[model samples]
Target: MLQPLPQEQTIMAETDRISQLPADIVDNILGFLPIEDAAKTVVLSTNWGGIWPNLTQLCFAPHFFRRLKNRYSTKHAAFYVITKILLQHQGPTIRKFEVDYYDSKTETVKSRSYDIDQWLLLVTRKGVEEIKLHLGSQEYRLPDCVLSCRTLKSLDLDSLLVRPLRSTYMLPNVASLRFRSINLDFFSDLVLDVPSLENLSCEECYEMFHLHIIAKSICSLNIRYCSGRELDSFIPVNMDLRSIRTLHLDSHSLQNFVDDCSRTGLPLRSPALNVEDLNLSDFCFKEETQASPLIRLLHICPNLIKLHISLWCPVTWRCDSTYDDEKDIPSVAEVDRRLPELRSVAQRHKRLVTLKLILFKGFWCEMLFIKELLAALPSLQEVIIGHSNDMDSKRKCEVMERVLHFPRASTEANVTCI
Candidate 1:
């Protein structure tokens, strides 16, 4: 083999290595870029010209069109660019398609509904697996084609209206479903039939008067800031989550379920017996009434191995008077009386190994709660404590020292305070 001359070697070193990459690798790189940036690569070199048309993922985010020349409005620009790309795309399959239009006006959404429907129709025909649509707070009825798309594996919708579906429509392959700020028609029972769904999340959604989830394959469920039409007439959430393993319920949703159960004389303990990890946010132990619901929720998950509790600090915790030693610290007997339900539940949770407490203020109530948890959980191996930002350096140090001295049920338990 003969070595090249110095001039030839220098020329070889300056060659466009990225442009010379294999077709599949180049397609992947283009797929990760914003549609606009990826489209621009077509002019870079002849090798990249065909790569943009074969991109498997297309994302038309608001910021992508925001940088365009102001010849047209953002909405119109997005419409033109996305339509052009889809029309030019030669890919055999689209793995993901996302349209996030947060700045859409109500009239704009209504006017563009037909365009969105066409987009969905084209993408569904190309076997799109994941579809995410964030069409602002307006209610745009999704095209019927999306409901019957068998190739869809994940569907995320925000601010849309779901009308009653025909019995023939089903999402047979969807494994993950997410909804935010959606309005559901009374006859729509779409969620009840997703047999392959494994993860379900609903956030800030309302007007679900009779939400029933009956997914047997679901492993994770998250509900946050969700409510029904009328509190007095709202029906309780009915779920058949026998296979659920991880659960998250915010304060409002949990309280609503508890209240509904109480009113209907239904058991507060759910059928989510397989849940091993539980996360409760905005939880407060300041009132005795609050303890009952927490206890009932724990009872629903006997196999829980990890527990995360974010204590809701009231205005009283920030007052200067709350720092007084005599007034702030409760006696041992008082602590037991105030938190008897928690103690009972903690004793029964022998399988629990990890405990996380967030927004800890080191008040006497919180300290006693920590002490009770430390004494009760014999299998607890890790304890993570996140102190509130309101605490001063001196106060944090004092709290850490106090926690370090607490007796642990597990000899190997490691405690970390931050």
Candidate 2:
């Protein structure tokens, strides 16, 4: 008999050890892999053949459907695969299910809508706890069974027009809710009655005229890019965020909403005042010279422990003293113009300890703004300055120098750059 090689002997021993593991242990190992990789295990060994059907989590994303380019091919292939998987699944409960059917073809989306809904119904009925669906551009009305699923703990909808069956939805157990690139018109019907929701985010949604989020159980609320210039004049977005502890808002939307509240005497409640952290971004100081919307947030979030802000400043303000509008750097005279507005709001920030500034371009106006912030927030202990990746090493060094030397109202404040 030919002598067995040492390597071959070791391989056989390892395979035997793995094969001896408990079925549940093997299933747990497979669960850690992506759904696509896990499916390949069926051919690896007999132990995996029955395992796929009992997987607790299923994630069939668009990355696996890349080969089927056109509408018909993807729709047919995805439908057959998902249907077969769900039909063959033997588990009594699925913990999580996520699908992204974002094809460009409108007809393909329409063709697969019913199949997707059926799959959702099947899993949700099986006591799935988390469901995330990202559909194409067309309007895909969600089934009533999914909207009313009491077992669902989390729901995420993206890039689809959601038309609930009824005027109001009551998801009693859902705690985390997110909507991205959705029609904001549905917020009234969708979010009104979700009593257990604690975290909510509406980002990049369109056509938002009025926001009426009044859920008292919410602890974190993020409203970004939804409130814009096109809001209908009659209904101002009413934000009732009394119970929230974390808040993130785009500067322009916050300014617009605040102005509207001021005009109508609508008492814009300082929800950020109660929050532990606040993030304000996506506003250019050049656009407005009035009370800095960002500074206003720092002042109001008195309980805040962390603060993040992103500002647009001129590159030449740090590199060259001469203001060149030709180089996109408004004159230093313009910086002088906005200094008083920034200074007017500069005051003691008693609770802030950590400050993070994103996209530091080293403009003089930004320099003055940082100076004012340092002069105000007395409790600040750490300042993190992050510059854009496009910035060169020399420019990064310059920006670091500017931040390090700025006078600090807090004696222990330290500055670091990234």
Candidate 3:
């Protein structure tokens, strides 16, 4: 067998040397560079170019490096340059397209171009995988073809808003989805079945953030600032997400959560999946009592270990002429549901280890929130309280003493307060 000649060896070294790097090692290094920079390697030689097309993961975002270059140079062609690279890439192995378009410019005027649609079509047709689209603009939906694509894995639509968009598309394969500042008012008949999904996020849901999840594989999620008085339209009981792990919930009204709770198979009762972390925010300004969903989380997330909660222990009361038989003094719900819940893993229950309570106004007192939590979570190693506010000198000592002392309520258990 004759070995390759000198010229052949030299040419092969330039083009095929990259193949020598372990596959995972190559991906790790390429992962750090923007997709365009990663693609630029191809120009180095055929070997490096081939590495990009075979990349199982891709991230294309503007690194803030230019921000460090000069104090004033950053406010220029950064976004347009990102768009340019996305359109130029013609690879099929892309698993993630993270387009973080935050305006670094003070007064940058950008004109709309149809190039976004063209590039989107190219990726979809070639079986590009995950897409994380984050824009700082009020543009709500991407082109129909991009959203309607069938091969997406995870999508994060952040800082999105209402714009000129029409009714179209059904996502069949996208799991792990997110929508931020989105107006889905035009989405009347949207349906989805993303069984492979692991997370779903929605923010600023003033208008209906309409969509459905047929997947039970979700692990981390966030639904915040959703003023949709009725959540049945956004998330029905039929959307059984039993696999949730990390969850952040903020709804417009109590009705939103209750409407969901009333749904058949929608009591947050999913198959035995470990839901470990939960953050409940976006409290309703007016509520008769704590919503049912929160009460249900204690019962549902049997494996929850970390918790972050923000609630409105209303400083004011409603003058419902009929219900106000008693003089209206400030009132918060005496909800028993949370008292036991804070105890579920010791309220932190199920090996609950960390707790962060922010804006812990009335709800904690309603359920003896702090007392029950200190009682239930014996496994707690760290606790952050009054996080939203800093403790003054006197208050700091008082707060620390209470926290450290509570763990010893039974027989002087050991708990360090820092």
Candidate 4:
């Protein structure tokens, strides 16, 4: 038999190259493309056709529908495309499923709510492990199937309304959960029955009167910008966080958490003994207030090894105050009056090894606070001071000099300014 010519051989090799690749590699390559584009690959070759149906991850983004021709309405086109893909998917278990639906008109989303529910039902049956639904401004009610999915390991939701569960729903395998800009008004007391959950985050969510988290295995919890209906009222979070090792809270959430502890008198009974890392942002230290929440957290997390605090400074300084005066350090009498509680808390936190202060303005109050901290924490090994962008070189130098000269309780402590 005569072999093919060199030129002919090259053509055959190029044609067979893609088909010869492993099925997992082909699936990964198709996974990067949008669901519509990945589905269209079926027409490329017989091998490609067989490969796309087994893709484990499917993402139906906004561009998936926007690229279609104007034969059908946007909502209709989206519904048709998603249904076709889910129906044709032959994978044993879809690992991840994401839908980012957005329309300028809110009525469009409302009209297609049923279709969205159907898509979720199909995916849930296929054993999807992760689901991310980012429905734009409109409030779409989540289907009951999603909440009860046993195979789900992660859930992320945004701009949706969560209704109260009729029966006790437990996500046995879910480990990570996140909510952004969600409305929980109808849910008077939201109970998270995730036994295996390890990480939980809530950002900019509102109208949650009470949150009852039953995640005994949770290790990290983050709450930022969450609030209640009334201006002064705050959402109370109730959980047995004895297993938690990391805690992050902004000013709003911290105040709410502190208030909840005070109202229930739980702080005195149970402190966060396992927490090793604590991050607090936008914390205000007023001169008149005798008790400080920052100090309260230090007391709660007694075993903390790392602490990050971002001081919240007022937009406008007092008219009588001078910003450039380096010698304007507060007297010892005044410093004691302002930060009386902090001194006691600092002395008790001997295990704290790292201290980071963000938005350091070298103000009199801030300097005094730093001085007290340096003199108290005997195990502190590193101190990082972050200054504002508008601070001049001269001002930064002045602040650094003062921080270095302040008496240190830990001989190994090194202070750096940036």
TM-score of each: 0.84, 0.81, 0.68, 0.79
Q: Write the per-residue lDDT of candidate 3 for residues 220-247, one digit (tens) a residue.
A: 7676666554555555323545667787
**Which residue pairs does candidate 2 place in steric collision?**
none
Error of 1 at 159 (Å): 1.2
lDDT of 2 by residue, 240-351 (tens): 4556688777865667545554565544434334777777776455555323555455445557888788766544344433233334645445655666645544444577
C-alpha lDDT of candidate 4 relative to the true structure: 0.75
On TM-score, the candidate that comes out on top is 1
Worst 10 residues of 3 by lDDT: 318-327
| lDDT by residue (tens digit), candidate 4, 1-418 | 9999999999998987987778788777877788877778756767676777788889878777666525564567777777787888787878789988776667766777888898889889989999999887545888889988999999998887778566457899999988888875655555668889898888888765555556777888888888776633343344566777988888767766666556655563225547888888886564333126666667787888998988766757532233235345554355556565777778777789999999877665677778888998888999998987656788778777878898988999989888
- lDDT digits (tens) for residues 365-396 of candidate 1: 67767887898778899999998898888888
Give residue 160's lDDT in candidate 1 (0 to 100).
79
- Which ranges in model 2 have alpha carbons more than 4 Å from their true place? 1-32, 41-49, 67-75, 186-191, 209-214, 227-240, 257-272, 289-291, 313-347
Provide the overall lDDT of each model, using Cα atoms, as 2-decimal numbers.
Answer: 0.75, 0.70, 0.56, 0.75
- What's model 2's overall lDDT? 0.70
Candidate 1's clash total is 0
**How much is the lDDT of residue 269 in candidate 2?**
39
- lDDT value for candidate 1? 0.75
